[model samples]
Target: MMEEDDDVTQGVLLRCLSLYSRGGGCKVGATTSDEFGEIVGKSYKPVCGAQDTSVDCFSYGVEKFRKKNNKKKNFQLQEPNHNNNEMHVFLPDDILEMCLMRLPLTSLMNSRLVCKKWRSLTTTTRFMQMRRDGYYPSPWLFLFGTVKDGFCSRDIHAFDVSFNKWHKIEAEVLKGRFSFSVTSVHDNIYLVGGCSILGKMDRNSSKTHRGVLVFSPMTKSWHKVASMKHARSKPVLGVYKVNSNHLTIKSQHNNFFRTRQRIGGVSDVYEDPHRLSVRRVSRTSFEDQKSKQSKVNKSVKDCRRFLIIAAGGFGSWDEPLDSCEIYDSSSNKWTEIQQLPVDFGVVCSAVVCNGIFYVYSESNKLAAYDIGLGYWARVQTTPPPPQVHEYTPRLVSCDDRQLFMVSVSWCEGDGEIGRRNKAVRKLWELDFEYLTWNEVCVHPDAPMDWNSVFVADKNLIFGVEMFKIFGQVLEFLTMCDVSDPKMNWVHVSKNQVAREMDVSSCVMKSMAVVHL
Candidate 1:
């Protein structure tokens, strides 16, 4: 019965649109004699009366059809009557759905206010499915992090790829929590376990929380999902779609030398486009594999295979993990992979590229782990850092293929009478295929100290940082195109009236890109 009603609705809607496009001079089909088609014809009268342009005419026809169809006794209860003069509309629902799928998220959000029909269409499950299936453009970068004020904020800022603009939204439903990891599986952004921000003033007093959050772009809302079994602070998060209906989330807590380790995962099935039905999996699968550590034997150890260690004591706070784990999504388990060489003790950053994990160690060396062969090798082709005393190295993976290494260094140049110290940052792209690094120029005047939460997309990098400009505190939310010849960094947050609000509080913790 429901399918029949849907077919009737579609037929009536398309017929009204056909007549509307011809300026109502054309006749509708014989179905117009039925009650459903009769309401559609009556709805067309008010729509044509409100026509101001071709676009508005089509919109009015669709909106009117939707309004009058609801008045039918079989469909549902009747809606309030709309003034003919005020009947604003756009494309037919089916056509509107297709058009909206191509729009950037910001414009799609604004479209919700156009009329009742648009609002209903944007929030429907079918529309969200379209977004998940790559009908829309590439995802936008979303940053939820801390600023300089020491107060964590629930506010989030997003960068739209279509407009090249950044805008803010109230997203901290976890009550201003920070240190969480953000992962986008399909249409939703999952906020994994991180420390609570409800009341901690200092880092030492902060407490870790196991709460997991899921944000839906369609509804512009956040809701609680399944929490991790172990409380984690600054965990490493990764998401993989097992199939059309299931997702496997792997998260490692920041216990093993701040490098973190995989505890367990929530094997979730899709309950809807925005929500998941989560079930906790046991750690024993990964834990039991630890007992078979000796199976690798002493021969493999001497043959360039490293020993994978288990989590025991909390290593030094200042040290990085010498070991790392590999997550197998097919089995829904994590296995202790390999240990870093004695010469490579601490790692500054790590990223996965081409099915392999690459880590930048504190010793200024690159380590590569191949998942298929289950072994580690050092890459000598990594670009060397600048010859400066104070420097920080970061590894960023852009859109799952391009790998970039960003370095910020303090350089001192000899002056006429003294020495001047200036901050210099450089961008380098690493070609994994050929194992070569090419330095991409960053503008000389670009602000330094870009050591806050940052994200990289296809050609743009979005970073948020606090700086003191002429004794005034300023927070810069910036976007830069590394692929551009000029390598310009644009300040996206400068034009907003609420820019000061961002400076007063709001520190960015983590960033992720979502498709819609």
Candidate 2:
């Protein structure tokens, strides 16, 4: 008798699911009330009425069973319905969150429109934290471009890795700006050092600004922040996080002792009978020095801030600058730092990994700046393959530990007599300890030209390809998973917004991956 009752309860749950899926209401007969109540607790009741009331009986029944069995779980159901024969279900907050978290990003976003409660639940801090920790959705690739008029395009195209679809985000704040460097830190996107028109009518009177604009995905708004001291155009921008744990007093102490030795060197040499007079220093001066040093150290160790490094860009006169500056979020100031190596030339690509800023220059040399140590050193590595011609290298950092290099080269294809030229792209991993490069994979179908390459979460590398046909430019996106053994290149679809723009005048500015 128990076995038959269990079978009947399972059948009822299946029927309810089928009805819900088909947009029909579930109706439980009087005969099955006993079995239904047995599954959904003794308090379960069905309501019969003219107005249709839909409920997720499938989830409700399972949750009730789990509770009755004393199974430890993270979620629980709400109070059971006691009115009417037509079942009206109300799910508890925890149970609803569990169901929503399993949805794909696109579906999850659409679920917000279902009702106010669902929207509020998904946007809660707890929900976002859980989603991020659980890696519910993959990262998105954002591509910024400029229209023919030299103004930043309002339409920002974002490609979803999991769904393989493109989404458009409007940037009304950046509509009138151009020549800005784009970088993302955590959840915020920064637009640094750009030129903007003074007014709508005075387009001829334009000026370069050191202002920084920040965009937040959660709020979908842009706001201006503290500007830089020097105006820069297309600067090499990177973000470094400084924590109290990383700052050490040992270095500060060593520097203080070095300064003391320098000051007392001559005084010590004149020691002897007059040593007491020569060694005597003002007590107030010593106390002031000690107090200043303590204050400086305390401020540095007390708060954590992100350092924005701006290096090597065009100055006001369109001259390439080797000067470098660092922006401190704590004090909201930009302090000039060590300049780039004279031989490094103009920086082509840069990335921050493990608190070190790595930049590749047009001179085909790679160099790294240690933010903590305040020093720069050129990275030594083997040259590109002999067959590669016109090699262009780009640096990408992944997971804050691994550094990968993507290079594109033109090569001659074998032909009977006349060889054809083709583009070949290769991926290499850098061993920072040994400063050696290991070839990861070679793309079989490389586009004629590559605009930018960026890494999304999970070691997925995306490359934007641009080529011209019939005097019009076209762009294509390709991706490769470094974690995959095959590591084959997969071609993603072209950007639909790019198709709508003036292809002849459109130029790709920057590409970055950020979690939404």
How high is the CA lDDT of each candidate model?
Answer: 0.50, 0.61
Q: Which candidate leads in TM-score?
A: 2
Q: Backbone clashes in each candidate structure, one number apiece?
A: 12, 8
Kindly list the per-residue Cα lDDT of model 1 for residues 445-476, writing each as its tens digit: 44434445556665677665654455554555
**Cα deviation of 346 in candidate 2 (Å)?**
0.6
The parts of candidate 1 lying over 4 Å away from their true place are: 1-93, 113-120, 132-135, 147-150, 164-166, 210-212, 223-231, 235-346, 387-391, 410-421, 431-436, 482-508
Candidate 2 has an lDDT of 0.61
User: For candidate 2, what is the TM-score?
Assistant: 0.67
- List, residue by residue over 68-125, the lDDT tens digit for candidate 2: 2233322223444744333323445776577666554544554453444556777887
